[model samples]
Target: MLENEFVTFSQNFLDRSGNHRSNQKKINEYLCKNSAQYLIYWRGKVPVVSDVRDQLCWVGRDHPLVLNYSGMPTFLGLENDIPFFSINISSWLPGNYNEAAAGAFFDSNIYNHPDLPESSFFAELRGFMNRISAREAELAVMTRGINVWQENNLYCSKCGNLTEIINAGWQRNCVNCGAFHFPRTDPVVIMLVTHGNNILLGRSHGWPDKMYSCLAGFMEPGESIEAAVQREVLEETSILVKNVRYLTSQPWPFPSSLMIGCVAEALSKKVLIDPKEIENALWVSREEMLEAFSGNNERIYPARVGSIAHFMIKKWLSGSIE
Candidate 1:
């Protein structure tokens, strides 16, 4: 019973004008408009105004960064007649930047651009996902996901030839094989399994200590969502599950993944951890989970906010998920 709007990146506030993506003339017209604005990205990080509320920083087409940028801007969509676009300025690097820190699991370093406002700095989406509005979160995730896909998939998989951007950054055409490729979104299932009064949680290897969340696994080809949920739970914790029901979903664009949230009834409670799959597995009662969520439990850390796991766990704690 989790509400859709509360989920980050789940809002549909912008109009994704798909029909106009292939229209070069229309795209050019929109680009030239005064109301058009562009979101800037560098090395997978987005620029945001560092304030009490982290707002997405948008610059005009005539800005120094945009003018100096070398590639075509990807048309995101229209927000109330105002066209929005995204462009990667990854080629521009800040002085004394640490590549390792920027690529860390939780990067807190902020990179400021000399040409942009002093209040604006580049930040990771996961760091401030819960601080921004749902609309801005959606936009930022969309821009980041698309840019990452474009960067990593520049070459054609069909023939190993270079591909050119098309359909306003939504599609790529292979120059040699004439094949079309679209952005790839891998589906993953994160489920909450329950038996009697306890819920299942597991922590993967290399995760921060004491941090545990719902068991999750990537869905393989030719597999149903429910089947994936059951198989993953069984494989990781040796727990048999039944009555697999979907609750919600979140667009986890850490590298383009759609998290399918589900609730399953556990037939057994004994946990046998699979070392290759996860570091540890445990069952926590409802009271212990509530304590963990409130930060009162010292031995357990709940899922991070702005994630579907956290949302589903909260719903289950409130007796909303059957």
Candidate 2:
């Protein structure tokens, strides 16, 4: 396990200017006066280097990769005096240019950050999560999730009228019906279920070959964290969990999910995986998990280093989880 490692979005370096979100006049004045930069997320394909390391590379507002916007860009709060903004471009930008990074992750548009000219400076942020600094990763995650919400909730949920960005880029307001909306973060419980020296690991159907990690599920309404942890394990793996406690959390913004990490004790060892929920589920000895972490295990590999699953298991292996 890597030492001194911070979860991707847990860094506190960026000072999100909360006061300026409501003060439109002041924010507008700052935007007009200060030399600000943008975190330009085109569709969700964040910019990164083409190297195997896949370093993060956030393009500036004036970069050739960015085209002129048609209207007010979704303004992300400020970091110091430097203002941050994001904009969504039309699909036409990728239709004319033909290099393929379009749509970033979910679509082919990632290939088209206004057309990344087959160079090392531009690539999609698919594998760059571990390669980049935690600070930048946090910024990218925040920038992407907010914009995706804005896109999905363009119209007010209450009324059909289009909503306008109200609290900076954090929220939207419907002029037609006076309704307000904000970016949402869905809570997910990711727990390391342990019994003696072994930890529970489950793999989803489409994961890479031999990859496994902790059991997790979305937190349903009215469910306490402990109850969700216990219920998720029982439903998916047929393992009852007890002594649930918070360990850590990671912002899993593949759209927007807050992965609340926890540690739980298993009451029943007999494994019966719901094939519909998990492809395979079993208990992995801590020694085997350690081996998997170090690339010595042939049967399975550890979770990606930046993920909450990796952090929790690594902490448990290092005797840090209590």
Q: Clashing residue pairs in candidate 1, if any?
A: none
- Per residue, candidate 2 scores C-alpha lDDT tens digits across 208-265 of 7899989999999999999999999999988887888887787888878999888899
Worst 10 residues of 2 by lDDT: 101-110
**Prediction-by-prediction clash tally:** 0, 14
Query: In model 2, which runs have C-alpha deviations exceeding 4 angstroms?
Result: 1-5, 50-55, 59-67, 90-126
Candidate No. with top TM-score: 1
Candidates' RMSD to native: 1.1, 3.5
**Candidates' C-alpha lDDT:** 0.91, 0.75
